[model samples]
Target: MTGFLAAVLAATVGAQAPGDGADQRRRLVEQKIRLVDILINSPAARGAAEGHEADARALIEQGHQAVDDARKALADGRFDEAAKLADDALRSVSSAARRMSSGEGALSESAQRKNLQDLGDQVGMYRSSIEELAKDPQKGTGAKALLRRVDGLTAESKQLAEAGRLGEAGKKMAEAYKTAVEELSRLRAGQEVLLSLKFDTPADEYAYEKKRFASNEIMVDMMIAEGRAAGDKRRLVDGFVEEGRRLGTQAEEQAKTGQHAEAVKLMEQASAQLVRALQSMGVPVF
Candidate 1:
């Protein structure tokens, strides 16, 4: 949480004084109710509900009920009851927010595991490609250093994962994957590699690019939701993602009009923008 938001929450949810007048207590309770509403309607809270996080959903529902009861108490001139109910609502809202925040942490851990798995897969793919290229001794000549670095990074990532430092593990794995990709790109600089997929039609190519673009967009969304892109970077990353979505929309329209070739190009551009967005959030993608 940011300092600004924490300060705001503190101010809104402060304890009522014993000497406070009825109107002052009422206003404080109302502020708390509004804060609860805002918290429960936030994107994270909504996502938790959508994901079937039972505890969070139940808490949010409980908060809503408390808010309703508090409003009724306020109307009936029961200031003490309204204050208590309002506090209940605030407690439920805070619990729900914490539950959702914990869920985000779990999600981050899961994503880190996936990243490690993906890095391992990319390493295998690159090794296989290198072996095939080695058939012509001249093709795989200059990749020894990069190959060693990738191996070292992959090993270190595994060690970090074993130590339960998944965040560090993911970063190491991303570095490994990026290194492998760079080496592969270097090896295939002049001639197309045998591993390159051959598409039978423009539509097939478009489908492939579209899938890639969607995957990249998903990564960008996850990073943004995790608050990885914040402050100044948030705006820049959002811009890239928005541009990517625009390009993706244009690509879909072109594809619908039987312009598969153009659609493929547009989708590729869209995917590139999404990749940039991820990179801006310090995530590596190939």
Candidate 2:
């Protein structure tokens, strides 16, 4: 059964189990333990850890042990003890996960607002970086996929905050930020290889230029797309993106004319222009 159904079943059984059979109570407790286990081991939970700090790991481990003890109690025909242990274990797991999710601690309203604003700024930076990274031949699709997940999380964060679920919203925002950081790390690693390419031979130089040209073409397209998304209010960003595209075109033309070194320089200029555009929007691309 789904976790939701399992939760409902546990609640229903708990309410009526005074008159119901001991076996039923045991099953309900087991169901609850199972649900908690699933939640504690989910990707969202792991991401909430930031790096699985010792305290967080300890709480989660304690919950697991409690659940195990609960199971043993149930087997020994101690229904009340089993149920209580299961419930307590579930709460422990949930509290730990919630604590980790918030990234720091529970935020007051003003703090939440400030933190949200900070996270939003980080998200904007990641969004800009993703636009450039998604043009890479090797890591483009992966970066795009990660950006989709980050977008979903950021949307959820906004929805939660709107509904006055400030604590929950903070957690969601933290998770989104963590995900974006991971994506940025990956994107940087991928690009570092290309950026480090040495033109030791004429063939190697030609290959580097060709690959760089293709990558810059995609980057130009992404920069344009970002500009359009920002609309006319961001005319300055649009100008930067336009200039970047122009430089990309010039780079390609220079490459065709066997001016590979100049072509590389133009590509660097194009990338800088795009980065400047993002910085103009309060996103630090560097």
Candidate 3:
């Protein structure tokens, strides 16, 4: 890859579309290309492609040409065409990569073991984060669902490893880690919203509540959706949900009777119950 070609490639990969249907296809193809690039650029793969496997070398050249053509098509405002060319590149590169080595990335057994260990550590970190969130009582159904998935994946990975299928096991563990990281990010976002509700004065409390009313409503709705989505992975949060609704209603009643301070306290209590429900699902609220 020359400097000019590398610059063009970077620009092509970084481009974002408004709402192109081909965007996903392009992204998937790009991932495949990178994987293939790592394999074929290695000494082992390079030797295999250049020596005793003329077909692999040809495929590598074809893949490079296809990528270049795809970049040109995108520059010319032809996303669909570019996407098809990218797919062609991916296919050629993948064929070459396989011919170069039986394993993905031509990973040796030691490298595979190290990769699996790293993935396990990543999953463990996510589990710790989830457990921390679980200490909260008002958020976590969505995260709990994800935790269940991680558990299943972890078990499956262990079974695969026991059966001597290290490659497949490593892939499953890597996927589990990725899923856990994504769930952790979602829980973190929810935590941020809840933490913003604190106030030091009654006036400040009332003012902040008014300002954040819409956000509070959205967060509540989000919790309900997460709870519903938890399905069989659901936690026991119905009582908390009911308590939140009751407190919110009472808060409204108090406000109607000119009990401003009491109304604010009741409203805060209502929010706390809702937050607790979210925490029960492993979302950290503080």
For candidate 1, write residues 1-286 as lDDT tens digits: 2223334455655477355587787777776765565555443454455556677778878988999999999889888888888888877777666654454322245545654565566566676666666566676556655666778998999999999887578667656765665566667677755667679999988876765664454455456556777778866876687688789889999999999999999998988888888878876445
Query: Evaluated with lDDT, which candidate comes out highest?
Result: 1
lDDT of 3 at 204: 55
Score candidate 2 by lDDT: 0.61
**How well is each residue in 1-286 modelled by candidate 3, as lDDT tens digits?**
1122233244444333336466665555554444334333433334444344567677777877887787787767677677677767756765665553454334455645655665675577567777667666665676677778888999999899889787789768866765665566777774452222346866556544432332233333344444432543232455565576678778768777777688788888777776666666665543
Q: Which whole-number lDDT from 0 to 100 does residue 244 have in model 2?
A: 70
Per-residue error (Å), model 3, residue 155: 1.7
Clashing pairs in 2: none
**Cα lDDT of model 2 by residue, 1-286, tens digit:** 1234234334533342353687787767766665565555433344334344556566667778888998898889888888888777776666665565445433346645655665666566567778778887988888889889999999999999999987678668766865675557656763452223345865456445443333323333233334432545355765675687678778878878888778777877876776666556544334
lDDT score of residue 27 within candidate 3: 57
Error of 2 at 160 (Å): 19
In model 3, the worst 10-residue window by lDDT is 1-10
Q: Which structure among the candidates has the greatest TM-score?
A: 1
TM-score of each: 0.41, 0.34, 0.38
